[model samples]
Target: MMRVSLSGARGLMLISTLLLSTTAFAAPDATKIANSVVASLQAKGGTKASFDSAAANGDDVVITNLKISNEGSEATVPSVVIASPVERTPGGFTAKSIAFDAGKVVDGDQTISWKTGISNDAIVPDPSEMHSTAKITPFSHFEIAGISVVNKSAPDPVTVDSVTFDLGNVIDGAPNDGKLAISGINVPGSVLKSAGQGASTLTDLGYDSLLLNIGVDGGYDSAKNALTINGITVDGKDIGKLAIGGTFGGLPREKLQNADQLKELAPTATLEVASIRYDDAGLTNRLLDMQAKQLGAKREDLVAMVPGFLPLAFSQVNITDEAFKTQVSDAVSAFLKDPKSLSIKFAPTAPVLLMDVSKAAMVNPNGVISLLGVGVSANN
Candidate 1:
């Protein structure tokens, strides 16, 4: 058990601000929007909520499944139906209602279900261990109601409702026996129209839908000193598809005598990128550019310098039908190999996409576009 102490009241304030800001939206009925958002999360099939018995000192904190259902058209959309979970915990509450939009036929249906589990560690746990487990079913006949801003050029505007997450789950007694999952994810279609940014950065690129699925299996065994992750799967029409398998083990606190002992006690897990599709050219370029900028180089400078330094750039610069696949592959490969990581002590006003330039620059065959710096950190 790894206990993560709450920094203080200030920490709570910071977390509250983050959650409030991330979920904030401009809607006539804030309650309706909130309900709809939670419903959407349940329908996506990856929502999870968990609790740790050790953290509360064996306190009976009930965990519940979340179920959401939607019906009707854009105009007269009916209220969302939310079902409470079977397990109960402290501060547990549930509500349901219909939000009416006059003269609009927002016809759609969605259903979601979730499950709960408890942690078994004795040490202090992270704040994420407060709940047991939650699983959301799926949303049917769903649609967006607002326009998304992707780029300067206005394309066909469409409504969007996206659910984002930052989750951590503890399995049994092992602290590292944890899992994280994200779903109900969406990207604006407009961002897909741009060529420069999407091509260079993954964060800037837009997606029709994205899902991250991860899990931990096996019972706690201090003697074996091992755990396993099922795998990671990413699915969506806009971003292509990807699947990877890997293992994680490195108990820095535990002292091992030799490499062989370490290998037997803590082995390396393989994370394989099974398949990738790069059909969204404009979005890909934007992502690449965004990534380059994060490394301290201007997008235009990288693009202009590429021809002089990298042979691949000369052949891959233009977004053409013939070169689209190769270009997208190269960009994605670059992103995966050189993902950004950093620690900052400042604040900013915009979204930040961090990068690991050293790793990325090494993988670039052309070497023309070297990563001057790595990682992105933003205050916004």
Candidate 2:
């Protein structure tokens, strides 16, 4: 037998208290958390939902056979794995991450399927209190893989490698900056064949099928009341890249939550600058070749005809800006001949209110061109 001193006994009691205190802070009820997540999703989409079972698997909660439906459409998810470190918050719940097993959605004659989806730093707010704040986004990072879309009229499916979106710099219950990327979108040839007039033009330009990637990077600064589109780009493997960018001012934070506000605010926004650019990969020569063949002429002859034909085309649109017209004609001729890059830019001396531009468009349409300080250039 061992004898313990009073101080040793006291130390043992202290250790025991620490262990019990730790147990008191053990993870929140996993089943309850799963219920909250389902409720949150149902509230957001205005849909009905049910799950076959929800149970704790180690540190994660696995919810199986979750079905969400609205109207005639239904989405069936095989399982959802909500990762550990989930906590109950005043709003509802927050998780380290949530992952969805491969799922398929059926709506009318179309079916959409995906390999998997994962969201990081997911915040599932209380369904009953969702409208009390402007918190629009539920995750900081989200990604889906192996997406396929099938339509009844289309003979083949459209496939995508991956889609990702990221949000950060949160303020006022919304993100101040974000980015979206979609990679390896493959449109099958059979689908393009079934498409009507637009498909004909695409086929003529040497695209029987299409492989494309899209990206958008943008942000809004609430303090400045300014919205900036850094760049939006669509890139095709054997075709040209189309890029657009713009900046607008005087967008209030109140207008960020819903579509109705966006419609109401568009007329009053101020445009600082905007641009559209195209960088040819292989499509330019193909387009010229196709056009020349249609007219029964050589490609160079087709390019030569454009400069002289510009004034006639511009006259039909009431464009009397001779210098601007000449600039455009020269740019088009150069672009068609060498096929590198062409860009059109609009930058006024000062920010022009959209309302003012709309009025100018209605009253003096030709003057609107000068008001925007439009410029066109090629191969630079």
Candidate 3:
């Protein structure tokens, strides 16, 4: 028989109590946390949300067939599991997730959908009862292939091909430094010309291989209300490339959540063109063709006539051409064989406001985008 002493019994009871306490504090209530997040988003109104199955597994809440906002623009998520160990902070109980799932945005018609979307997000609400700000941490990536904008109403639907855009990386720096890097868009030259619907004067300018590639990178400092564009590169493949950089400030804190607030703030900014490299002959021939078509003449007759008016057309800035006629042909020949470059630069005198841009877009009379100069000739 087991014999027990009073001190031994007391020791046994203490061990049992410790075991129960450790189990209780081991993990958070994951299912309860997930329900709260989904409910909050839906409470914003005009939103309908539903999930196929939700169950607590280990420390994560697994959800399938999660659909939200299924009316105008619907989101369809196949599967997602979130595990947030609730941490009480100065702001209150904050639950954020590094967990996410791939999803698609289905158009209202149900005909087209955008696939290839990934997200890892955190929603921190105002725990102070004031609810003054949106403490949102967002991280997402979208890679779209062969995008097409179709106007079904038109008799002959306009179809553009080979469209692609992607955001490579993002960081939600909080309590630590964040990062933003590498996003770009690419389109063929043909699409730009045909976008007008009715084609006319320059339809014969054949540049099949020409492409527009622009890549952007920079950091946005929310604390200081500043967005610095570290690099913006525009590549024309065969024609040339241009690079620009600048900074923008004067962000309004009150306007962050309101779309109407966008109009009230005037951002102050400065921009400078770091470099412009273009194939001299390629540019000359491209213009000569346009002039020939407008004048109802041939390419040969227009080449010489075009150079005579080059300085006048570019009256906005000084242009230097040594042997204008011969150079244009030489440039065309050089670029046809291989890529070549001419230089350009632009530096504005004063800072420009974003609102004034719409009025000054055509002339830039304020010299906001001063054309420092450009040098393009066949001889070079």
State TM-scores per candidate.
Answer: 0.25, 0.92, 0.56
Q: Give Cα-based local distance difference scores for all models.
A: 0.32, 0.85, 0.48
Candidate 1: minimum summed lDDT over ten consecutive residues — where? 50-59
Root-mean-square deviation of each candidate, in angstroms? 21.8, 3.0, 8.0
Tens digits of per-residue lDDT, candidate 1, 108-133, equal: 33211112112121112122332233
Give stretches of model 3 more than 4 Å off.
1-30, 83-102, 109-117, 120-135, 140-214, 221-225, 232-243, 249-258, 267-307, 311-380
Give the per-residue lDDT of model 2 (tens digit) for 1-380.
99999999999999999887767645556678778877877886768888988887766788898898998999999998888746655656777898986998999999999998999988888877576345656789999999999998889999999999999888766788889999999998788778888876787676878999999999998887888999999999889899999988878767755566778777668999999999999998887899899999998988888788888888777888778888998899889889999999999988899989988987775788889988999998
- Per-residue lDDT value at 314 in model 2: 88
Order of all candidates by lDDT, from best down to worst? Answer: 2, 3, 1
Which candidate gets the maximum TM-score versus the true structure? Answer: 2
Candidate 2 residue runs with Cα over 4 Å from true position? 1-27
Q: Ten residues in a row with the worst lDDT in model 2?
A: 128-137
Clashes of 1: 66
The C-alpha stretches of model 1 lying farther than 4 A from their native spots are 1-190, 200-227, 235-240, 251-380
